[model samples]
Target: MAAVNVALAGRSYEVLVGSGLLGRVHCEAYSFLEPYGQRSIPVVADANAKRLLGEHLQASFRSAGLSIDWYEVPSGEASKSWAELEKLTDWLLDRGITRSDHVFALGGGVVGDLVGFACSILKRGCGFVQLPTTLLAQVDSSVGGKTAINASAGKNLIGAFHQPALVLADTACLASLPIREMRAGLAEVFKYGLLGDAEFFARVDADSNAILSHDNTVLESVITHCVGMKARIVAEDERETKDARALLNLGHTFGHALEAETGFSDTLLHGEAVALGMVLAARFSARRGLIAQSDAERVADALARAGLPTEIAALGLDCDGAALADHMRNDKKAEATTVPFILLRAIGEAYVARDVELADVGTFLDEQLRAH
Candidate 1:
């Protein structure tokens, strides 16, 4: 087992990562839950993951003399809506969950975001644990303490900064994940490299196949590396008030817009949207002379090598630049007439640019869409 801590001052927590970690979660999460007394563990997982890993968690908790109630919701980004939030909260209330009880988020990013947010607002605040089962969640979302629900206005419009008491990322879950999902998860892992470490990007580029094939050693190393990066940044700026947390959102500005335009459909996975978004950022950075064209090409080439989408035109998205830019204007990062973008100066370095003009963004989007 490997562990990293998110040092959020008073709300610090540990992130445990390893293969078969799910089966051993009770022992791992017990210390966090101890602070809340004998409060029942409300396990929240997506339908698919509930069958795959939730049972083990439930049984483990039961065996440890801990009370647990399993709750399963349909999977996907759509599950982050208000309706689902209300439904899940109602279920929790019906089960008699109190402020002292801890909700265990036992799935991917969507499940973790929704459940964590639900716990945050329940009776003002309740404890929660994140058992991120997806590669994307394990390395990014689940570690950040930024729990949110999607509003009609945009993605993650309604949420809170309620950090989890613990985060358990089990590598065993990846063994059964579909290949496309695995590739999508790698997009976020790639984002870590693109946003911060050039050498990490090089490492991933070299071991892309090994990481995708669920090679145990490679998976552990990559997850640990990515989580360590996230933990350091999150510990420094938990609320994104400073620029520290924004670096983690390297491709999210464009990615969130793509998700909204697609209505958060399966047509474009978050990772797929992010893959294209990072390419867009790189291409635009190169166009603006912030980075060289060769750097942009290398970014695209790396994504393609990982089997991730690198071209917006190829996605068959119905919207053009104007439409996409409309979506961008509504992004949470938007301020007045500009959106904070993490533009790359090179393969491994990313910076937040708050002076981006929409006209330029529209022009770039138009060019990319035209190629499709």
Candidate 2:
């Protein structure tokens, strides 16, 4: 098992990455809960995850003399709404969950975000554990404390910074994930390299096959590396008050707009939109002479090779560049009238570009739309 510690002053936590972690729930849960003098846990999961490893987790916890109360919501982005949040909180209250109790989030990003947000506001803040079952959640969403639900205006517009008590990313869960979901997760894995480590990006280009094949060794190594990077950044800038942690949002500014345009539906998964957004960021950088045109093409080519979308034109949205740019105004990174964009000075070197004009962005996106 590979462990990364997110040393956030008083809210430090461990993120454990390994195979068969679900089977070891007894030991893991006991260690985490013992510190708080708890013997029972409330789990909030999606129906899909319940079908996969629910029994194993229940059996493991039960065997350790720990009781579990499980509540499952329907799968998908639609579940992260006010109505569902109300239902979940009502359920937690009926079950006697208090500020001192820890809630277990046992699914992918949707479940994690929803449950975490619920815990944050429930009784004015409670504890929660992240049991991320999907690749995207394991490497990205699970580690960060930025929990949120989708808002009518934009994605993650309503959220709080409530870090998890612990994150158990069991690689074994990936075996049951659909290929498309796995490919989507790889986009974030690639983003870690693109934003920080050039040599890691080269390794990903070379070992793309092994990574995609779900080779245990490669998966563990990749997840550990990504989690470690995020842990260090989170420790430094837990609330994103400094720009250190904002670098992690390299592809998110453009990506969130794409998600909004697609209505946060399966039409464009967050990871898929991010993969395409990174390409757009690279291309925009090239247009501004920040990077070579060949470098932008290389970034796009690598994502395409990994079976991810590299162009927005392919999404066939019925919107123009100005419309897409309008969606970005709601992004959390926006300050007053300007949005801070994480653009590349070079591969592995990302900086926040706050002077990017929305009109110029619309024109650049217009060119991209016309190309498709």
- Candidate maximizing lDDT: 2
* Residues 134-228 of candidate 2: C-alpha lDDT, one tens digit per residue: 99999999887998888999998888999999999999999989989998999999999899998888788777788788899999999999999
**Local distance difference test values of all predictions, in order:** 0.86, 0.89
Estimate the overall C-alpha local distance difference test score of candidate 1: 0.86
lDDT per residue as tens, model 1, 1-372: 789988877887888889888777667877755654576767888988988776677777777777666788899999999999999999988978888777888889999999988998888998888888888888888987888988888898888988888888889888878889899999998898999899999899899999899998999999999999999998888889999989888888888888898889898999898998899999999999999999999999999999999888877778779788878777777888788888988888898898898878988898998774
**The CA-based lDDT of model 2 is what?**
0.89
Error of 2 at 23 (Å): 0.9
| Runs with alpha carbons beyond 4 Å of true place in candidate 1 | 32-40
